[model samples]
Target: MPWGERPRWARWVSVIWIVGFVEGTGAHLLDLISGGLHAYHAWPLPSQVLFHALLVVDLLVAVLVARGLPSGPPLGAAVMVTDLTANYQGNWSGLLHEPLAYVGVTGLLPMTLFGLFVVGTALPLGRAFRGIVRPV
Candidate 1:
């Protein structure tokens, strides 16, 4: 079937994945410059490594987004979960305890966006496949 003839939910899922990857990549670049990543104080070295690793992961997500294939949802799901953990840890590292901590906490915005993307992509994608496999 042609692209347009595909399920509308699938198209929306693709759009969400595309947005997630784009936002993820942009957030990483901003962190590199604005020192926004300092929110991750515990195990600073590993945190930095994970921070950079996400850039690679985001690139992979971008490819999946461009392809708009069924695989995008699962990959985006993984990214969303990872982002949640990372953000939670970063926020709780006592980095946000100081007076000016709000500046660093801004990293959560991308995380929030990631959650939205995951929900947008997964909910509709799940609906698209709801009846695919019948009971044996």
Candidate 2:
């Protein structure tokens, strides 16, 4: 089948999936190149470690979502929710940094928008599957 022949929800989900993957991967790379998570400022070592660990998970979710496999939507939705929550935390913590503060500030809106899109597409896919199994 041609790529666009899939359900509309699936198409939108795939779009958001790619967006998230690119954004997450970009953030991690920026963090690395800037000299580790807290290298710009100073956070406790444990918190910094946990922060980077979460970013890794974020990147993995992006990969899963971008794969666009038929079975991945619901799981990707869950991951997107978690990822948004983490982004929220990052936004709040970002208050501590002056020069880099825009990272958190600018991300808030896109993250919220994509988070909604992920959740929106995930639920319908689940319901559609349920209908398929029931065979009305």
Candidate 3:
């Protein structure tokens, strides 16, 4: 399908995902700016660099996806999964204790859900947006 021919809802989902990606990146950047690099010293330099680099790549993928590229959602989901893996590893223990930490960890649940939703519904949603999946 052509980029301009995508369903409206698919485009909206893509925009939502793009906003989420940008918000996530902005939050991290705010952390870095407010706390300085010392705050992330516990993480290895290479890992830190890789995480930020991936965020940029994710944003780019999101932009492509928002433009109605068929390959965008899967690639975006892949990058999101990588990020979720690293985040889970880093914060898994926090879920065991500390109410504040628990809240913070759970806060990521929505993003995970959104990623899964995008992956699982990509085709159907696309079809629905294109009016192929009509209402009963």
Residue-pair clashes per candidate = 0, 0, 0
Please provide the root mean square deviation of candidate 1 (C-alpha atoms, Å). Answer: 5.3
How well is each residue in 5-71 modelled by candidate 3, as lDDT tens digits?
A: 6666666676777787776667667667776665466666755775657546756776666665656
lDDT, candidate 2, 1-136, per-residue tens: 1235555655565666767756766776788778864653454455466457656666665555555444456766776676666556655655456535454545666667777877876766444433332222
Clashes of 1: 0
TM-score of each: 0.64, 0.59, 0.70
Pairs of residues clashing in candidate 1: none
After aligning candidate 2 to the native by TM-score, how far in Å is the CA of 28 from where it should be? Answer: 1.8
Q: What does the lDDT read for residue 111 in candidate 3? A: 61
Runs with alpha carbons beyond 4 Å of true place in candidate 2: 1-5, 37-50, 89-105, 125-136
**CA shift of 67, model 1, Å:** 0.9
- In model 3, what is the error at residue 131, expressed in angstroms? 12
Q: Write the per-residue lDDT of candidate 1 for residues 1-136, one digit (tens) a residue.
A: 2346447656666666666678777777776667765633454576677776777788787676555455556777777787677766766755557635544444565567657768555645543444242222
Two-way lDDT contest, 1 vs 3, winner? 3
Q: What is the lDDT of residue 32 in candidate 2?
A: 73
